[model samples]
Target chain A: MDYDPMVMDDAESLGPVVKISQADNVRVKFELSNADLSFANSLRRVMLAEIPTIAIDLVEIEENSSVLADEFIAHRLGLIPLNAEGAESLLYSRDCDCDNYCEHCSVKLVLHAKCTGGENMSISARDLVPAGDRMHQTLGMPVIRDEDGLGPLILKLRPGQEIKLECIAKKGIAKEHAKWAPSAAIGFEYDPHNKLHHIDYWYEQDPKTEWPPSEYVDWEEPPAEGEPFDYDAVPNRFYYNVETSGPLGPDGIVTEGIKVIQQKLAGLIHELTEGEGGDNYDGPRSPEYGGGGDGFGYSTSYGGNGGNQSAWGGAGGTTPFGQTPYGGGGNTWS
Target chain B: MNAPDRFELFLLQDGEKKIVETVVNGMSNCSDFTIKKEDHTIGNLLSERLKQAPNVMMAGYKVAHPNVPELFIRVQTDGTVTPREALVNALKQLVAAYGQLGREFQKELALRQYADQGENGDGSGAQGGTY
Candidate 1:
């Protein structure tokens, strides 16, 4: 077998590879309300239209499956029951007119009874049986169950006739609001291909002015005659201003205030390359700093070299705040 | 010959000196004895008479003899009444005082079981008793 050395070096140059083996991240938030269609109806629509089965296959799902799967699991475990009466009430709404309960609406099943009699009993659409032959237990099955363990019993029912059950539907809107009106805007931004890249979430907040009036206006004049004028202004002039205050109505008053704010920009750039004297330039040549240019090179007649040797020497020579230095002069520069 | 209203007999063993086995049966030939509702009181009276004979051990027996009410009597080693004897005597005295109350008690128990069944009124078989 031929081993390629270049391949190994290439892999090493790429640095430590940290690949995401499993990217099954999901987040879901549910807002419940009763003014709109019942929560049971919204959930039913999600189950029937979006995802058919309550038990979703995590391996086969895409990014958005979390919303459906979360609601399914929550409903299966009886976590979010109908609460039209109160927060803790688990009754489904009885107003839905659908022959077979759909996502739109259904009745709430509060009470459950299990008989040890020979005859079978008919349960309402609100009733639920956790496990049965007619139940949508597995994935890819029909969401709505027509018979739903409701047929007549063939054999004699004896003691210990077990029936596992829960509520049939919930009552609330998809977005929780007492008035049943849904707000139009909600969104999030992320790189699906690479999750670590960036993520931004956006939601509506109380509207207000984004940018307030400037507290100061800066004014600048061109440099004067002699002494090598510093063309760049050290500090700019600022103008201060304020907006007026007024009363909106008989009981409401609005006030606007403005003030000058000082801002500072300071940073240090370290050169990685070793050098002796500022002339031995070994650092990143940024185009913005006039180091690399595609056009003709223009040299300053007065300056000794095109590089910033003089300014670098002056700044690097002195140790700030009486800090100790390791061997002064050219050796320290190296 | 008139039938004896009550019978009394002391079973004994013949020896050089006669040994009284036990006063197996003891009854007064009259119906004058008032029935006591308390079983323990009846058991105390039976124990007292049985302990009179010396070297005699009163063996326990169930009194189902005809013309006499059934009684369960126990003879203790030291003339002390056992709880079982007291209970049986109490039950016997209750039956004697209230003649047909035993049949009525059974009927009431059956009716209770029927009511506990809720809507199911089928009384075809013996209703399972709850302790």
Candidate 2:
């Protein structure tokens, strides 16, 4: 068959009903109907890998005497979910017009902790203060708190130990690194269907009754008549469950996942139909979740999509978990 | 297809506030709800499943005091819809997607199984004759 990249079909699909059974900021559940398996799988895939989240991709450690190694600390910081509320106003570092890093593309976080006396100390997310006004000015502090309203514990320090570092937070997908994943758990399953049958308790209570079975445990009151008891079977219907780690709420993750997928599909359609001039393709951009921008440009690199990072080439210890081994330095690069 | 008799299941202490004793149930713990200990399985299953709900505000479960065996499951919505309603809707979405995946798998299996037939030019699978 000739190469025809099918992004979407012309035929309209039926709309599914969304019934919320429980909800909070990070966890949620709902029942959906009329949707097909394709939609649910696509949604799961998108939720897991497509959603854009802000995470510390680059870390520069200046001084470290703490128990945890530099890379371990960096990994912990990388996994900390920043409040990505105003991320839309910022461009992907690669896409920004700046030659390298810019305020519009990245958030700089600085953490300097030291303990000189007495007992060991604790360092948490609240200590990593946002350097510039971007996140603080636009989205507020990027730290997320636990259910007890405490910041996520990043590391601990003993007396006379210190750790000073800088982190660059950027927008990226979970496919690149799970640190950017918005949800902790997301799953669904076919609903089970079963029926109950009323037992003749009066007859079954007799020891000699073989028809009703005396051995069967008798209920205090006979069950109301209804469908006969049978094995529960998986039906076409499903039960959905979602839990968020931080950043976006569970409901927000699903909504954003669907929107992100739609945008990507549209972008793909435009690319296929309009040839190589994808830059000039007029397909609609996915509206950003909270505000600021309209276009959803998929960047290939963690750096703003098209920006240069040759100066810090040696700093590229790009691994699945955030790990960068940089020689100790005191200068903060913009 | 809708699941019959969809309901919230929870195990509450005799005098404990229903919300506090359980895991994260919603944005707040003001509702008084209870369920049989036997039905705890339903909550466990659905609790694990609901984490995938779209736009979920929060998702978590608490089983504090194991000796007492009380399980708390809370699903907070983003306010786009109520918690319970979101659960039903999400399930439908999942079922739909799974169905599509099954059909695609079958189609792919059939093609792979019949690949040799197409090579023989029987017009059963892959078209031949030109590059």
Which numbered prediction scores highest in DockQ against the true structure? 2
| DockQ score, prediction 1 | 0.00
- lDDT by residue for model 1 (B29-127), tens: 111111111122233333432333222134233444434433344443323443223323333222221111112222332344344344345532222
**lDDT for A70 (candidate 1):** 33
Among all windows of ten consecutive residues in candidate 1 chain A, which has the lowest summed lDDT?
A256-265
Which segments of candidate 1 are over 4 A away from where they belong?
A1-170, A174-196, A199-334, B1-131
Q: Which regions in candidate 2 have their CA more than 4 angstroms from the true location?
A: A1-14, A135-140, A193-235, A275-334, B1-131
For model 2, how does the per-residue alpha-carbon lDDT over A52-95 read when each residue is reduced to its tens digit?
77889889999999988899999998998886644555666655
Question: Residue by residue across A1-334, what tens digits does model 1's lDDT show?
Answer: 2334464345223322111111100111111111111111222222111110012111211222122353443233332222121111111123334664433332323324454556644333234333222211211121232356332221222343433333344333221221111111112111122112222324255212333322111112323344463443122111111110100100000000000000000000101112112222222211111111212122111111211111111222111111111111212112
Per-residue accuracy of model 2 over B2-111 as CA lDDT, tens digit each: 53211111122233322122234444522211222212322443444454454455555555553333455566666666554544444433333333332332233334
Q: How many steric overlaps does candidate 2 have?
A: 89
